[model samples]
Every structure is written in C-alpha cells, then in structure tokens.
Target: MERIDRRLGLLFALPVSAILAGAFLAPLLVVAIFSTMPQKVFDFLHWPDFSSYRVILEQGYWRSILWSLGLAFTATALLLVICWPLAYGMARVFGRFTLVLTVLVVMSLFVSENIRLFGWFLTLMKGGLIEGHLRAWFGQGFEGLLFNVPAILFGLVYVYLPFMLFPLAQGIAMVPDDARAAAFDLGASRWQVFTQIELPLAAPGIMVGSLLTFVLSAGAIAEAKLLGGRAVIVIADDIETAFTFAQNWPLGSALSMVLIAVVGTLVILGLRRVDLDAIMGRRR
Candidate 1:
C-alpha cells in the first residue's frame, strides 16, 4: 500500500517536473550555447569558442557596465532607505492595518512599470502638479527636474518599492517579540535596539530584497528613456539600440550575456553569504 502511494505521488509530480525542465532549463541551455558563439556565426551552433565573451571583456562595454552597476547600487541604496522604516512600522505597529497596506502595495505592483513612468513624465512636465508647487515656491518650475538623473532614480524607486518593502517587513515580522521587549527592558534606546538587534536579524531578507531591486533597476530601459531623455546612455538602452537600429542580434545577444554575467555574479556572491537555515526560519 505504501509503495502504491509513493508511485501515485511520483506520477502526480512528473508532469510539473518535466514542464520545468523543458520550459526553463531548455532556454538556459540555449543561452549557454549562444554565449560562446562568434559574432557572425549562423549555421554552426555546436562549435564552442570564447570569442564573444572575449569581445565583451575587452571592449567599450565597460562604460555601460559601470553605468549599470552605479544605477543598480544607487537604486538598492534608495530602496533600503525608503523601505526600512515603512517595513518596520508595518511589521510592528500596523497589525490590523497590515492587510490594507499589503493590498495597496500589491495593487501598485500590478500597475505596469512603464505606465508608472508615463504618469511620472506627465506629473513632472511643466505646469504639472509638482511643477505648480515648485513654480509657487522657487519661481523656476519643473523643467530642470524632469528629463534628468533624479527623475530616472525616482522612477526606479517607485517601481521597486514594494519588492523591497514586502520582504523587509516579512523579515521584521520574524524577529521575536521577546527580543524587542528584552531590549526595551535593558534600557536600550529605540535607535540602539533597532540598529543592533532588528537590523541584524533582518539582514538576510534585506539582502534578498535589495538584490531584486538592484537587478530590476539595472535592466530598466523605459525609465531611462522617458525620464533621462537620451541624456544618460544606460546599458539597457544600448542593448535596445543594438537590437532595433543596428539590427545586430549577435551583438545584442552578447550585450545581454554581459548583463547576465554581471547580475549572476552578484547574486552568486550574495547567496554565498546567506545562511540557508536563517532564510528558512524567516519564512516561518
């Protein structure tokens, strides 16, 4: 009877396992294949060469790379700063309000990122809401504010806030009430307790959330296009240019591989620092 039950469970799991292998694993195999191919090669897919990777390593791609890294880190930093207090508040102070707040966050997440950028574009344009306020205060309006690095950064944070908030709040939720009480009982200042105890316990979740925000912001194209106004040439826009105008699939593919390499390397480094047990415990 036990053997029959085990066989039945395997039968149920087989289809989902096979779909995962075929749908996801197969494309990864193709990416691995193409990452090693030459710039002009077409007919031969099996041939292995490091030429594509070499070009990626030894070329002007470095500038775009630095730009991506800078944007990603900046976005990560902003996300942490903005979400930390909100997440802590949600976990500690807003028990009955948590569901309502979570619903709003999820709704914002559902709104398309491109659409959000569009909304900001209109909002930042001259005579818009923000512009009206600035015009009243400083007399010089939103012209300088729109189509700049600041707007692009704003769009990035707006789009990625929930991603950072959700995980961080969950992390804070996992901290023992007793730990917080004990800290208070020992006469630790609020700042001291948060900095020393809460933040350390929440580190793993913060890392995961920040990594997500970083990767998303790094690859973002629409925000730079709509907000930066061609002034800033991000790596993602370069890839789009390669694909659309240059019509260079090989170069575009190569560009994408560089992004993949950079992001994958960061993720691997982060994974190495995370304790698996701690991560699982946070989920509980």
Candidate 2:
C-alpha cells in the first residue's frame, strides 16, 4: 500500500516536473547558449566566446549590477523590519481582525501593478494629491518626490510588502500558544519570549520572505523606469536596454545569467537554513 502511494505521488509530480523543465530550464538553457555566442550574430556559424561577459566587466555595466544588488538588499531589509511586527500582530494580537488584514493584502494582489504604480506617481507628482494638500495646508510643497531613487524604493516596498507579510504571519502562527503561555508562566518577559522563542521559530519564514523580496526587487524594471527616471540605472534596466535598444542579445543574456546565478545562490543558501516542512506545517 505504501509503495503504491509513493508511486502515485511520483506520477502526480511528473507533470509539474515536465512543466518546469520546458518552461523554466529550457529558457535558461537558451539564455546560457546565447550568452556565450558573439553579439549581433544571428547565423549558426559562430564560435562561443567570453566577449559578452567581458563587456559586463566594464566600469559602467558593473555599476548597474551593484546598484541592483544594493537596492534589492536595502528593500529586503526594510521589508523584514517592517513586516515582522505586523505579521506578529496578525498572527497573535489581531485575532478576528487578521482576516480583514489578510483580505486587504490579497486585494492588493488583484489590482494591476501598473495601475498601483500610476497612483503612486500621481500622489507624488507636483500639484498632485500630496503636493496639493501640503501646499493648501502649509503654503509650501516639495516637488522633488517623483522621478528619484526614494520614489522607486517606496514603490518597491509598497508592491512587495504583502509577499513578505504572508509567509511571516504563517510562521508566527505556527508557534504554539501553549509554549508562549508556558514561557510567561516561567517568569519570562514578553520581550524575552518574543526574542528567544518567537523570532527563532519564525526564521524560516523570514528567510523565505527576504529571498522572495530581494529576487523580485532585483529584477524589477518597470518600477525603476516609472519612478527612477534617468537618475537610476539598475541591472534589469540595463538588460532591457541591451536587448532592445542596444540590440545586443549576447550582452543581455550575460547580464541575465549573472542575476540568475546570484539569486540562485542566495536561494540555495537560504534553503539550507530553512526547514520546508516546518514552514509548510507538514510532517515528514
């Protein structure tokens, strides 16, 4: 019976495995092949070389890579700091209100991303809602809110907050109420209970959320384009320019491979420290 169940599970997983190979791995393989090929060459008669990678090693290109990494890291860190307390509240303190909060978060996902960003654009624009209100009340308003680095960061945080929040809430929710009560009964302060118990138990979710936020933020082109204007140049923007405007597929593929490698390494490292079963509330 157990053998039959195991075979059935494997059979069920075959479709997903095939889909991943075709949809994900196939594209990556194509990108890898193209990354090694000479740029501006569409012919089959071409030699694989490191020229594309050498282009990426240039000072200007390297700066874009650093910029993307820095933005992703900063945004992920901020999300963790902001979401931790919010998730804890949703999991423990809010009780019936948690449902309302969850619905709000999920609703954001249903709205178009571009529409949400456009709303932010209007809010921050000169003579828009924020400036209008400020000018009306304070007789002065700042007009430098849009088309800047801070605007891009704000948009990114707003868009990705829910991704971090849900996993963190789930992790915190899995912490046993009895364990918390026992800690309190043993004269442990609330701070001590949270610091020593809750935080440690929620580490897996924190890692997952951080990885997701970092990966998404790093690859973001739309937010940078809309909010950053010409002041910011991220790796994703560079990749898009390379492929589209510059007409350099090899260079674009090289940049994409580098991003894929970095994100993949982070995910592997995070997974090493996180227990999937624990995070999913599943028994082995």
TM per model? 0.85, 0.91
Candidate 1 lDDT over residue span 11-124, tens digit each: 999999999999988866665666566665553454667576666567776677777788778988999998988998898898889889999989876878888778888788
Q: Write the per-residue lDDT of candidate 2 for residues 1-284, one digit (tens) a residue.
A: 99999999999999999999999999899888888988766543678986889888864687888888888988899899999999999988999999999999999889899899988888888888889898999998787488888888888899999989998888888788998889889999999998888888788888888888999999987788887774789999999998899998888998999988987888898889989888888854
Whole-model alpha-carbon lDDT for candidate 1: 0.80
Q: What is the C-alpha RMSD of each candidate to the true structure, in Å?
A: 3.0, 2.5
Predicted structure with the largest TM-score when compared to the true one: 2
Stretches > 4 Å off in candidate 1 = 1-13, 40-49, 57-59, 132-142, 275-284
Runs of candidate 2 with Cα error greater than 4 angstroms are 1-17
Locate the minimum summed-lDDT window of 10 residues in model 2: 37-46
lDDT of 2 at 228: 74
